[model samples]
Target chain A: MSLESDIPSWVQALAGGGLIGLSAALLMGLEGRILGISGFVRSVLEADPKLKGPSTAFLLGLVLVGILAQFYFVDTLTNTQPRSYMITILAGLLVGYGTAMGNGCTSGHGVCGLSRFSYRSLIATLSFMAAGMLTVTLHRVLMGGM
Target chain B: MKQQITHFIIGILFGIGLLLSGMTQPGKVIGFLDIFGNWVPDLAFVMIGAILINSIAHKFLMRRGRPLFGTGFNLPSKKDLDRPLIQGSILFGIGWGLAGFCPGPAIVSIGGLQTPAILFGIGLVIGASVFIVKKNQVK
Candidate 1:
């Protein structure tokens, strides 16, 4: 379907897609670990000394690129509608709790899990999508089509 | 030293992928989630492409005895369909639709150190702490 949009570019999408896959595979190949963003965040916050250094380094790289990209690759990191701080915070809390409970997020399950042929990931992905879709419906209904 | 550098580069690669794929953009993510609305299926392309590439790479990688820096591959071996998995996923989906910022893009946004994302990151830490204290098993 790949409909055209101001934001969606098929070429870039595919290229980005490949890079993500390669990045995860590269990490797995080299570090012997699944490159789950949620896991990285957790490690940064709580891992032992050995894991801490690499996790911090990864986050540092992310921020470094994020800052430079805003100046150059400006369109890459656009924020939307600026929801109320309360709603945003609540959303953040929900994401944190959910990811922790689920044992992974998009990158962990969606990318790495599915790639490895994990049936758990398939179900988790489906459940998350279904839940996400339902949340959207609830959001629209409750927030007056926000 | 080598491990640190690899992770840094991988982070950058991942950040760029997220940005280019529009996963870093809240509007685009929300658009993808709202299946009843004018859903944008662009992310579908991103996921498919990644999965195909990774699937191939996975076969080769798993064939190896050990990783370059570790004693073994740290892949999750769990196969159970438990309540936590289901409930947690639903909770995550709700949060994702609410803000369109997951752990990946949310952490990437830390570069700018903006208020909303920073707050979200803080919340993320707190959530992790609570789960660690209570559940003790994270994927």
Candidate 2:
């Protein structure tokens, strides 16, 4: 079933995706950094004072936009029904551990890694995408609806 | 000083991109991943758009052999295909499929101070922290 909305989903994705790409480019051009949110989030939580400054600033920037969007793009940022806390937290744990262990997430492996044409990234991307698809399939089967 | 400032500004831009792309919506994310179900292909366009621009930028920037602002490009160097890479990613996917929130969206959602996002964030911190501690113990 296709979703019905005022703006087409693909258009939203492509335009927003371009901005994400630009953001990565700017980071590389100006700061010589890969804009991997998982890495930054890990660094912020790691207590390394040296890394704290840049990582914190980057994360804060994301949060700042979040705050601004709450006011400006309220409809765009729609709220979803909360899952059980146990399930939500469990999902968080899996994400945290998985990204940490894998050393990258969607942005790291999917965007930057593939852009660099690393075979390693290709494998990683395929693996995670497959896993996500499988998990969703299982969820739908066992849990009924999401 | 300049480095930190740059990260902050770019981070804001990245966040905005995420919101504009409709990636901030969990339902959309789940829809995209739900190949067996509705199978929304919006996320594929997002990836295609991002990769197309970044690939062009990468070709030029890498040829420069150094970043405009910093000493060198801080790209990942590991070439080996290892177990952790595959296993960790699979695990992350399961979590992502479960909640439809990845690290970026989860963090962005926190700006709104939503309960689910906050809870996920806390769990993310704990999960990552556990890995760090376990690695430290092994070391």
Candidate 3:
């Protein structure tokens, strides 16, 4: 299928977008920290002395909520496709290490930081997008489109 | 306690939001990244919508001296840019493009029992640990 044909309807996008924004806002207003997924992962994985409790709770919430949501949105949402296990591992390494050192990810840098007009976020967003675009192109050329 | 409960509620809301928005789907993410090809711009709207709301809300939220649950709003105050930031972002971007699974969506995928998600999540955990180990060694 052509890429254009793959996008979801605008209504779903807007509603989902609004919910994402609201969720980030609620976290900020309530917890006073950026909802960057990488940061959360780092905190939990590293056993960050300061972030242990909140991070655990947040991660738990993310997964628990996801399980419940899948049942509700089964008709609209599809499960993640399996790729070559090697590809998944390598890519996961890149994403995880990058975000761990960089201090954010799509949620943190793309949404939260960009909204704050942080210069770092701007650079990060561009970098990730460009990298993502280039990687996709390379994958298309090399892996024959996974 | 109360804070943990709130976090749990937010997590559920965030997951539902991601699923409803199709952020949990790899094809959609690939479509968004495939800007040069048969581009799909719908996910852009999700990003824009979230940013717009957050941008507006942050301004107002900043006025409050203390957070609802804590003593203060612990915003990232650093203004300096560094190598780690750029390098990290590039790697993240490449991985994101390759896998279409950032930590958030990857975790969701894992929650849903996707095999790729499981592999990627393991990578994420190990990769992060490796970075920590390497960094500690350097220090």
Candidate 4:
């Protein structure tokens, strides 16, 4: 049976986006910090004395929440597709590298940036969209329309 | 006082929303990105829904003289397009295309406890560390 039979994918996607946006707003309001993943990741790794405490708590909370969700809601979500694990790893690395280089990720720039009407965010979001388009084009060419 | 609590409450609701939505699934994300293959245009509706909700919130938020928690709106101040901006965009694009997981979804996917998310989170930490160090070194 198709997983979509239970809940429509679009509803799921929207709910996900809303969660991210709302969390970011809350974090910023409470801590006076932007809920940018790149910054959060950096703080955890480098342990900057100034940002260490809050960053660690935030990161731990993030992972903890995920684990809790999986335990309680695994059946609700479909199993991840089996594919080339190597390719997926490489992709993740690239994304990590890119967000670091870009000073933010889609959440920081695309969602928060656009909401704030930051021109820089606009550029980043456009770049993201363009890249998605190009990747599709190349994939089609390589796979002969997979 | 209450504003901070509201923000935290909103964050919890947001997390719940992500759980309800299928946006955390890599397969669904890749499927939507699969334009030339079996592209699913349904994600467009997700974007639309988010935009609609955000639009309403924006209108209400804007009516207030200042944000409840902050002195004013906490928008980004940068406007110029610089090298970091260009290079970072290209990198983000390449990464998203390759992995089908952007930061937002990646963060949410951690809930799945999947291997890919674990690996991705590791890489994310490493990359961010490197960037911070390099940035510090330059100053």
Best by lDDT: 2
TM-score of every candidate: 0.92, 0.95, 0.92, 0.80
**iRMSD of all candidate structures:** 1.9, 1.7, 2.2, 3.3
lDDT of 4 at A142: 82
lDDT of 1 by residue, B17-51 (tens): 87778777777788888888878788888898789
- Candidate 4 ranges beyond 4 A from true positions: A1-7, A25-33, A46-52, A75-83, A140-145, B1-12, B62-73
RMSD of each: 3.4, 2.7, 3.3, 3.6
lDDT of 1 by residue, A17-109 (tens): 888898899999899988888777777667767888888888787888778776777567777646678878888888888888888899999
| TM-score: model 3, chain A | 0.84
Candidate 1, TM-score vs. the true structure?
0.92
Pairs in steric clash, model 3 = none
lDDT values for all models: 0.82, 0.86, 0.80, 0.62
Instruction: Summarize candidate 4's per-residue lDDT along A1-146 as a digit string, tens digits.
Output: 23345666666666656665566655554444566666656665677776666655555554555566677766433434433677666667767777877777766776666765678877987887678667755755785654
Per-residue CA lDDT of candidate 2, range B15-113, in tens? 988988877888788888899887889899989999999999999998889987778988778999999999999999999988888999888889977
Q: Model 2 off-target regions past 4 Å? A: A1-6
Measured by TM-score, the strongest candidate is: 2
Each model's DockQ?
0.67, 0.75, 0.66, 0.44
Model 4, residue A5: displacement in angstroms?
Answer: 5.8
Candidate 1 clash pair list: none
